[model samples]
Target: MKITQKDVEYIAHLARLEVDESLVDKFADQISRILQYIDKLKDADISGAGLMAGASLQNNVFREDTVKVSPGPDVTLANAPERHEDFYTVPRVVG
Candidate 1:
């Protein structure tokens, strides 16, 4: 679980991080512990377990896609301060 200053520097370079020289030792220790934890996880057994994409067992849970009547064009146009034909018109954003 021991990590060196050189390892920290290398990791920082790979990550494109501007790490402080003083914090290199601390960063190295933290990274080393993370690697050690991963190494420990590799020793555990999970051979027969099914692969799970998410926590819940529910799949394709959705409401039926059906068209329902909302407000008509006239009712929608009434809410708009300005409208052209059946659509709301706004100031041009770009030429």
Candidate 2:
């Protein structure tokens, strides 16, 4: 895939990029080289290679679930300025 100045201009217009006129040729050359490298990679042989589900082998890095005792409401609501029985009292928000 050969990249030309017109291709660069069209791509820049689609991406809403303001590519400088001096850098158009440089960008075209770089993009052409990248596409050529990709084409070269497409010709590589991988018929004997095994398919991989993931890059790493690590799995389930989590602690086991366990039942724990809850701190009673008295300890939980100790810092509240106003309390009603077992709940913190807040000012009414709706009229």
Backbone clash total for model 1 is 0
CA RMSD for every model? 10.5, 13.3
- Write down the TM-score for model 2: 0.45
TM-score of each predicted structure versus truth: 0.46, 0.45
> Runs in model 2 with CA error above 4 Å?
44-95
- Model 1 residue 75 CA deviation (Å) reads 30
Itemize residue pairs with steric clashes in candidate 2: none
Give the lowest summed-lDDT range of ten residues in model 2: 55-64
User: Which residue pairs does candidate 1 place in steric collision?
Assistant: none
Q: What tens digits encode model 2's per-residue C-alpha lDDT throughout 1-95? A: 89899999999999999799999999999999999888886788988999788888887688779988989999999998999999999999889
